[model samples]
Every structure is written in C-alpha cells, then in structure tokens.
Target: MYIITDQLKENGFSVNRLDQIIKRNNNKRQFNTLEYFCIYIIMENIGLIVENTSYNITAGNIVFLGPQKSIEFGKAKGQDTFIISFSSSFYERSIKDSLFLNSQLFFNYNSDIFIAPFSNIEEMRVVFMDRMENFRKKDKSLYLSAAHNAIERLILDAFLHIPTEEVKKDIKFDYLYCVNKFKVVLQRDYKTAKKVSHYAGELNVTPRKLTEMTEYVLGKSAKHVIIEKLISESKKMLSYTNYTISQIAFELGFSDEGNFTNFFKKHTQKNPSEMR
Candidate 1:
C-alpha cells in the first residue's frame, strides 16, 4: 500500500475512503482527509509527487509514506489500473519501518520509496479495490481490523526484506544527504574514532569537504554535530532510562565511564551523573 499526505485534523486526521478509478477531472480535488496518511497502490498508471520526489509509478506497484506526503493526480492508464491510499489511522509501525527502509534509490524530496511487481497484480488490485467498494457499500460482514491487517502484511511482505543505501561520494550533494553519511560512518566507527578525518575517510571525501558542508548547512562544524548527537542520545538514556552509566558509555562508544563522563561534560557542560 502506498500512502501520501497527512495533516492534523479534528478527528486525529481525517481519512479518505479510496477505491475504484479517480477521474482526472477530480484530480487535485482533495478526497478523503487532506491531512492523513495515504497508501497508494497503482494498478494502471499514475504520476505523482511524494515528499518532493516525483514518481511515474507503474500499474500494480505500491508505495508507503509516513507523514506530510502528498498524492496528486488520478490513475489514468491504457490498461485497467488501481491505486489505493491508506491513512495512518490504518497504519502499522512495523509496516512503516519496512516502507521507510525500502526507499533508498530515489531522491527523498518528501516521499520515501517502496515498489514491487506482483505476479497476481490484477487479483491483488481487485482485493484492494473491493475494500473501498465494501466501505462504500458498508459491508457488515467484514471485520475491518482483520481485513486491514491481512492486506498490510501482504503488501509489505513482498517489498520489505532489505533497503538500498543512498548514493553519495563527494560533498556537493543534498545538505541532509552529506550530514546523514557523516552520521552513519560515525555510528559505525565511533568506538575508535576522531574530529573529522575519521568520518571523511569512510565517505571517501576530504576532511575539508566534510567540515565545509557541515559548517555551511548547519552553522556548526561536523565534529560538533556528531558529538552533539551522541551526547544528546546519551542524555536521554541517563535522564529518561535506568541504564547504567557504563552501559550508556559503551553504547555511545566510550570505552570507560570516565571517558564517557568527560566527553559528555565537554559537550553538554554537565556530568552524566548530574544529568541523570
């Protein structure tokens, strides 16, 4: 199931009952909830934007979205096509994780990616379309929750094994892209790591490039950002959870409590114990 668009609404975000063909004349006219999660199952064809990324989604392909994603355009293709959207009111977290991870190749504008070709595409399409059809007809015999869960698992199971990594090599990419690469390398090697050289090496870029991107985009050095993220997560554990200081230390890649404490103090101006 592909979802798009979610906003705060009176009923915890209203939902649109989606099934059947949405005509081009009705395109851009918000049906269902303007501010709810959307699951888009395209059977025929539809080109739409999710989270700032454009998709020329094929018939029988699916995409899932979390929040603030939009779905514009109605399904209009030569062969019979079906597209379905599910709001978060019907969302499942495990499924959400699967959807988030599935998006790796595309540039994440506002949408993340999840797509799979089904052998029984037409049958699956009928099943989902029947859902909205039943909703319209008020199918008293169907147990709503059971039907929802079964479909959620069916779509996710096909697409949720492993995710592709984002492509990045040099500094001149998206601001978030560069920073995220720095974070990934930092977490991977933080146990035995440094200011900038350590991370830049893993990303195959120079320290100068790393520092420049971080400073320009974040108004702080990349070094400060890494230390801050580590310290921030550490503070949450120390203050919010009962994990031992040593445990938090090791989790953040500190070898010893003293090292952890000192590092935390340097960044946060408070000792771990005091923060706790």
Candidate 2:
C-alpha cells in the first residue's frame, strides 16, 4: 500500500511497504498522511483492508486510496501489479478538464474508481503499462509531471468503461425521492442553513418526515446528509481551489466567514488552512 503524509513530497512522494500489519488486525497501527491520493492495481489473490473497509482488487481493475487513509494489503497471488501516488496538483493540470469529467468513459458520480471490463482493460493496459514502465525506468528524459499525467490518463480510461449502477426499479420511492431532492436543495443552500428544519420547511414536510425520508433513501439522517455533503464540498474546494477562506465562505453562502470556519473545524478538527 502507498501513503503520502505531505501534499507535495520531494521528487513527488514517499511510500512505505506495509507487510504484516493488516494480517494482525491491530487498530493502533494506522498510517496517517496529509492531503494526497494513490491508485493500485492488485491481483485477485491479494486483498486489502482500508481502515474499516475490506476489498479485493482483481487484475485489470483499479482501486483508489485517498489522503489520510490507512490501509493494509497482501502479496500478489500470481501476476505482477502496480501502485502509483500523486498530489492533487497532478490531477488539476491533467485530468481536471471538463472534457475528462464529461468523458463518461473515465468518470463516475457515486464512486471514486471507474472499473473497466477485461476487453477494454486489455487494450488500454498495453498503452498504459508502456507509460508506467517509462516512469518506472526513470529515464533521464522522464519528468515527474509527465509520469503523473500518464497515470492520470490511465485512471480516466478505466473510469469511462464503468457504467452507472442501474437503480433498482423495486427500490423504495421515499428513499430515492428524498435523496434526489436533498441533493437539489443542498447544492443551492448547503452553507446557508444546513439544518434539517430548513430543508424540511422548503419541502413542506415535518422534521420527523424528513428524517424518515432520508433514512429510507440514504441510510442516514437529513442532518447527516447535509453535513456530509457540505463538509465534502468544503474539502474539495479547500484542497482543489486556491480560493481564500472568506471567499469560499461567501460563495458557499455562509452569512459570515467565521460561521463557515467554525462549522468546518467542528467536523474536520483542522481549520481550512491547516487542511491545506
């Protein structure tokens, strides 16, 4: 597994081999880091446990581990694998364009990694592995920026092939409706009210109804959904954009910047700049 404690390390990153820590399952051995992201291609035989999440990475598929994430994995069963790490800056200049976002072939809304099927992965991996090899070889002409861009393109191609999960027709309507509606209102006013009652009033529903609806749709309370979306959006802005604290607060519609800072600090422990 790869972990980056700092956003931009010298020559780009620092990685440590995590051997038996995960097999033992002790909670104390956590690898903490600053804002960063990593990608891994694992054989089906190997496995990983990230914090409380357990997953297996089959060949031709990609998995992502983001900053401040602690994880553990096993050795490969047969074929070789890959692990690439980079700062967010790598993404902005390479994969952050609107074309990449709309490329559908390499993007998804609900999940971080977009998995491609074997046929597509096979075709893509040839070109991808070539670039990977060039970076690994550390040729004198190779630059850190070029290496990051190649890896980013590979990630996007993998995502493009992953289709959105078909929403089950039999799923509960109360849940689906609430989640969609909540997203609509949330994007409009996440920073202003961010209270259950505020959203409930807009929907003309009672707080109890709002809670029940949210639980049905998202397995969470209305308040939790609001907090999660706001906090997540706040972090995305704080990390990806160069906006100042007050400008961010004002844009998000906070009455004042102090309220926004307090709200963010309450959830994340670190203030905005500290997060950066």
Best by TM-score: 2
lDDT (Cα, 0-100) at 225 in candidate 2: 82
lDDT of each: 0.53, 0.57
Q: Least accurate stretch of 10 residues (summed lDDT) in model 1?
A: 7-16
Number of clashes in every candidate structure?
Answer: 24, 6
> What is the C-alpha lDDT profile of model 1 across 160-185, one tens digit per residue?
43343332223233454566456545
Off by over 4 Å in 2: 1-8, 13-34, 75-79, 94-141, 162-222, 226-276
Model 2 local distance difference test score: 0.57
As a whole number from 0 to 100, the lDDT of residue 14 in candidate 2 is 26
TM-score of 2: 0.43
Error of 1 at 130 (Å): 3.1
TM-score of 1: 0.40
- Once model 2 is optimally superposed onto the true structure by TM-score, how far is the C-alpha of residue 42 displaced, in angstroms? 2.2
